[model samples]
Target: MRIFAFVGVFASVVSLIGCATGLTRAGSMIRESTDLSVRNRCEFIGTIDESERMGAGQGDNRRGALNRVRNRVAELGGDTFLIVSLDTDNSGAYVQAEVYGCGTVGSSASHAPATPAPSGREGSMTTGSGFYVSRSGHVLTNAHVVEQCREVRIPPTGTAEIVARDDASDLALLKNDIANQPIPAIFRGGRGVQPGAGVVVIGFPLQGIISSGPSVTTGIISSLAGPSNDRRLFQMTAPIHPGSSGGPVLDDAGNVVGVATAKLDPFVVARETGDIPQNISFAVSAGIARAFLDAEGVRYEILPSDPALPTENIATRARQFTLRIECRE
Candidate 1:
């Protein structure tokens, strides 16, 4: 029997360049809408995570996977999806594998269309996850999505194109050939989120053909200003998976407070040898994101404006790698 459920979502937004258009305004337009749900937009792409030895036949497994996808789709209000490719080798008792894929969704319908897959090209080569952020063709995604690529394809309409990406921050900026489209996402604001607040993590985890669409999980803010080596990051207790990188982390009020970046406990060198890491996750704070945009000269303003955030803190801007690597010895 197949069952369907809704996946919940967190909130966030990002961008580059000091432009008059395609910028995300922080924390104002995030009212929960009835239209944003899995029943309306989420779709599946291909298979990335299936097990033949799990005692379930292909049909049973496929239905099980789709049900998972359906649940996630309802959570993030995402319409676009992707399949991540993995490099694996059979090891008799089990298969060893590494994850590689992208998935994305928008809070709004103004997302640009994806480019068509070329005939005979390996489907795995395509970038998968991304979300809409601006009305003028700007989309936000991990810089790794378009990394080393001459171009990338957007969703729903097969719109292929080139983009200006910033690799240092693992963030990319896409200039959609599509015109005047609004990108919907949780808004950012001057009032930063506090620790222990409720949060939802949204993304596509483990590429599976039957298991496609947005996924959501709930937890609380573990820390408001967690350390990312020398950089500051927001930490959370929400369980996350491989496909969730570069997605949104939302507050209970449905406002975007951070961008999903990394799972804290997945870095174990021996993940299978009793080295299971607790599923802690981290995100780039909205303040840091705002500073990044400011350095790039992007023209976004925070909504419901914050009077407590230091003007210097809000005004400071810089460009740097967003990933923080900390090894506990």
Candidate 2:
């Protein structure tokens, strides 16, 4: 009888240790996949699901569900899993993810440097907001800001060379020659963003006439889809002005969740629907932005997820990379 009791206690201890180790490995592997090259190494495996238990709070349940998904991916010999979708029902939270085998790293594609801008200007100055994405001084902003401009200026960095632009997504990439650089914005991958997440926007509003420094606005993600249920865009409650275009819509952890693009025109909408929309702004989702950057062969960094920081700290960190984009058109 004593031998049997000892065997049972030992089995329980071993099981507990195994569970702890699995959780730790899952977290480490997830962080490792944040590297673009590392991510490229992985090939999609299969989709997996994890459901939360009943009687648990929403937040706790969601976390538990995610942990289980990660654990399962690891068990299937996958290094990482990209979140496809998440849903909740009366029973509990459910997570669906695509598994990948990230064993070998892949090489990143390269592109030619941006051409130098000519030393001539002949247009009115229009200012917008942008942020650095790479150590090579690649800046991201709205394509419309520089589409018709003869010269583009990024303060402290002087003139910038337009490298790439996607009119459909309203994203443009610029290169600068400044030696001193700011903190580049980090992006969250896949379906990292969800509705109701806290968000903040930093930009030069009112065409930068209101303040010499960038302004900050705080709100939460109103919806995962945009106007007319557009999947590429997301809606947020953050107030964005004309000059706020091309700015970074950051999460509480200082990760770039989206790019502040446009706000609903109250006049136009009211004329059509006989009603005004308040704080209905739109941002290009970070996942879509990441795809554009990859297609352009732009090197950028990603973070799996960072611990939540104070709003003030997040804004301060963002300002490092955020710059005022002046277009001479």
Candidate 3:
């Protein structure tokens, strides 16, 4: 055969250049192991290196690194959350970091890192995306990511004292022990999921850095309901931003149902009209996330065989733990 087809196309182009040089060093070691695992799950929030004599009446350098990150989050011991920055406001000097307190901070002899506040320099951290609806560890984010966090750290994983927060449905409900573990997610059951179906959305957006990972987006259900005096709300063409406000939307069988909050772009104004109405994105109904987990009593369990027939009365070990968690997702 023509010289064995030119040596089988030169050994398949040298085995595709040795698998593209081992996938370019396995994609730079998976982006430096996801940037050192999100800088070991952030929580530093403090550093302004003596803002020119301890922030002399703050008014520059990003207001003295936001007043030395509001005075070391009031002397490092009570923070719901913090993230001040000033990189170069004419270099008046700045860097204030602090992320400690929620319900999880590591180090049973391994994940130390909780002292480098910078000027002794170390600055760089991030770990703020959330999920896990309720199994006991609770969790549901976006009260501006722990809002006035009086103390909320989850470093290396573990921390959540916050108990209840609604903030007009911006939602929040922390508490941690990570209970039985394996808290990925699986809620759905809001019933009859209409409008075109198919969807999926997971987050970690921006928190994992430069829009890190866990991001997956697909769309449909561009409006099964909304503004009919708010039929619990729903609308999705999928593109969301601002770290995709409180994640979770899934449905192509993954469950979840909805949670992403808002989006609405449309402010066009071009004379003889050629382009007008555009924009819409809201979501919050999986039956208002079962009325936000039945107003926080949160129990969850209704997927015995679920095809859409769910009202909740289920029992029998909660329908065999919701049919073994919908057959392992």
lDDT (tens digit, per residue) of candidate 3 on 1-329: 00011111111001010001111110111110112343345444433343533443323344445455545554654332333333433436555444343222211112233433212323222233456665676666544445434355543344466666554545555655643653446666545677887666554443312434445566788777654335665777776544455666666656667666555423211111345434356666666666766777876644422543222221111221110000000
lDDT values for all models: 0.42, 0.68, 0.44
Over the stretch 106-153, how does candidate 2's per-residue lDDT look in tens digits? 111111111222333222455678899988898988776676667788
Expressed as tens digits, the lDDT of each residue in 157-252 for candidate 1 is 345443444444455555555654444553556567777877765655443321555556778888775433424467788865544555566665
- Flag regions of model 3 displaced more than 4 Å: 1-132, 143-148, 151-173, 176-185, 188-195, 198-220, 223-255, 268-279, 282-305, 310-329
**Which has the better lDDT: candidate 2, or candidate 3?**
2
In model 1, the runs with Cα more than 4 Å from the true position are 1-118, 126-128, 160-163, 225-230, 265-275, 297-301, 305-329
TM-score of 1: 0.50
TM-score of 3: 0.25
- TM for every model, in the order presented, reads 0.50, 0.62, 0.25
Top-lDDT candidate index: 2
Residue 133, candidate 3: alpha-carbon lDDT:
61
Report how far residue 86 has shifted in candidate 1, in Å.
23
Error of 3 at 1 (Å): 66
Q: Candidate 2, clashing residue pairs? A: 123-329
Clashes of each: 34, 1, 29
